[model samples]
Target: MGESFPMKSGDDSHSYSKNSLYQKLASDTVKEMIQESVIKYLDTDKVTSSMGSTTIALADFGCSIGPNTFLAVQNLIQPLQTKNLEFQVFFNDHFSNDFNTLLTSLPPERPYHAAAVGGSFYGRLFPRNSLTIAYSSQSLHWLSKPPQGVNNEAGIHGSGAPEPVARAYSAQFEADLGCFLDARAEEIVSGGLMFLVMPATPDGLTQTELSALFDFYGYSLMDLADKGVVEKSRIEEFNLPIHIPRLGEMREVIEKNGCFRIERMELTNPKSKVAGPLDAANVVTHMRSAMEGVFAAHFGASVADQMFDNVVPMTPRIADCFKALHHISNQLFVVLTRK
Candidate 1:
């Protein structure tokens, strides 16, 4: 199974809390869309009636240590609050996530009962039919584990992998997402809402800027192996736990799961507040914040540090690779309702 790797913890320069601007931009981009979806598809009256209560129970899956998670929760809650209903908000992530940072950083005077639930969302975390809403942003692309039968010669990321390797990644994603929907189907009450947002490709699109970023990293590792700084066998054994699904793949998984009805699905282009493409330093920092733990776990911390430090100065094309990062419509946003 693909192990759960938590985002880099703490509030320092390399922390996920500080480096997750792209995710924040995504949440901001979808804020209005989420509100509109809530008003349009969230059956608050039905939720209350089905659950025999006024306190609506909601959970944010894969909620890493963040201000982004808080923003997303508030956006979802605001639409429901207009109806004057009570809420019990659950913040969930892998067991190793920094709950201390996540919980303490919550807005003071926030109106709602709050608690943290730690576990993989691929399995059941709550009692059956107990939740009124489920939300996950920038989370679902992570498979429960790296796929079996993939090796270094196939490349590191699904976007740049060979055909057979890409198929392996897709198969793993389908299975993982199936488990996720099954768990949610059991936990969520009828008429509850589920909203998902993550990076994904549209049908027939072969490459994305995100893919190029990973391919760049793969090349860096290869260069390191050539210099005898890292073993070639190590690269062969490693695969990133991320899979960017195409639109059709997502629809297929939801359909196969037979749990929820898809209400809205589309691709969105998030506009960054910053003026230009991220410089090599910021780009590397952002990638490290989310992925350093994974790399450290695969390679030792010292080796991982050397690899990243070497990547910037050795590769001048990194900046050009990410130039159109924000301009592309790579994000998948979908709203579903429990049947």
Candidate 2:
């Protein structure tokens, strides 16, 4: 997974920078929900002794750039600070993620000792029985690579695809997630917790708002191809290396993997909409920050730039496309415990 699916290269110009858009809009809800989960699931002394130690091991698997990672770590450890627990916090991401930015911006007063492990979450990055709590958010839907030769140029939703393409994506996710569970099962202590927050896809493999964003995203690139901004073949070959799954699919992966039991599963309300203009701009910057580097890496820098250039004028239309996405909920939050 690390070799195949590294994030778009980590550079400030072509990189995922610390953006206020995501910090203000995306992080708070996750912080609150994850905190609530910690309050309920983090039985410090018992969990600590479950591993025969008073040191609590916690990690954020896809710790993206900036204050959100800072915010999330703070939220997780601050609550535990009142309790008697020493912590070894590991911030893990692909080698391409901006760890320098993350380490530099650590809270002036951190609650726990922090370190970073650079690798993909789909493989082993920690030793056996090492971690007590692990969390991943707004990630996990990304497959290790795009479905080989599978095309969904007309629509972004896998449900809308024909048999072969849909099957390919599904199989890819199953394999990636299976690796994720198997790896974590080896790393986490018995009865440890993993809190996952993923974008919710609607049931029956149909298109949801989350997928529709890709719809518009793909369309813009395809349009650029028409205008000769990018080679049509490049657009044809490109597929977002991401998929959002229904809750059942996620749960099934966990059950089939045979290492963890589901403790809680939740689908939160649709993503909150800010005012129209800010919502539109925020929408563009948010998507660009997370995806631009990846797109550049997969496609070329010039083609990806042309694609996003086509995307800007269409930004406001994102509002309507987003409104069209009335899926199960905004984000899905799930809690899993080692069995």
Candidate 3:
């Protein structure tokens, strides 16, 4: 009786109603790396002096729920707080995000403010050179637009497979990267630092790999739909667009924008060493939220639920996916300093 997992919004933006599994894992890994990167990038003198006198303005773009946002800010501020910097924090996300949920996550004693700005990050959201630091995690690969030629109506399935699909998506990714960089350049202070972490393929942006992942899941969902266990209509209306940019491609965008220089880039894959298989499945489930809409659209709501149920039972396969992903490609961590 419940609506399908991938609910369609009034706006064209697709919603994967559940929290992303991959995002949770990636957040833990990236947040650690970002903490280290920011410490290294901040000016030593400012780092020392700001301990007492400076009012540091920090913003987390695409900050969702505020738990991770708070965690990231805490990581950045804890070290600097000892030096006397007065921290003023801001959380940014789509207008649709639950500001109440985000606010409840904040510590009662924390010195911060919240802004609910509903719009894509195609331009500056803050006054020119207002923020001292900016952070984004697991969010950048989501382009404001779908790939140039790929039609969402067609579904991400078909005979040719992922190659054609990824190519179309990558083109749009390149465009969005430019817009993101340009906007950040205008909003961040000259010496501010920006840390971005997202799912990226080291071999560069390949539509084939992306498409293959989608196909695998697409079939998996269809398998469930065939069972008559889930609704078909819900899946038909859902679609998700995700694009992972290559390091070189990102570099070009940053260079062209002339707002920031790369300070550090690292590729890492983190997997649970915990013994249970469900933990791994949960990780995959988290990752799926970002892509669930696509499956929902192609298979329909009934099929999507069935697919999720089916996948939930396959612990070994879940472990294999995580292990294979770890062995194959590393997630990216990048630190950029404003010019």
Report the C-alpha lDDT of model 3 over 1-339, residue by residue, as the tens digit: 112222222222222324443455666776666777767778846533543336787888777664556667777677676665566787776665556666765777775554555445656788876778888886787667555555443344322435666567666777777888888888877768888887666664343234444545556655655766544444454444566666676766677777789898777664442243225555446545544554556565555656666656655654554454545444678899988
lDDT of each structure? 0.86, 0.72, 0.62
Q: Who wins the lDDT comparison? A: 1
Clashes of each: 1, 2, 18
Task: Between candidates 1 and 3, name the one with more favorable lDDT.
Answer: 1
Looking at model 2, the pairs that clash are 159-205, 209-325
Candidate 2 lDDT at 217 equals 72
Q: By TM-score, highest first, what's the ranking?
A: 1, 2, 3
- Between the candidate structures 1 and 2, which one is better when assessed by lDDT? 1
Over all chains combined, what TM-score does candidate 3 have? 0.76
C-alpha-based local distance difference test score of model 1: 0.86
**Stronger candidate by TM-score (2 vs 3):** 2
How well is each residue in 261-291 modelled by candidate 2, as lDDT tens digits?
8878877753553433236556666667677
Model 2 segments more than 4 A misplaced = 2-15, 151-159, 273-278, 326-328
**Candidate 2: minimum summed lDDT over ten consecutive residues — where?**
2-11
Work out candidate 2's RMSD over C-alphas.
Answer: 2.8
lDDT of 3 at 299: 61
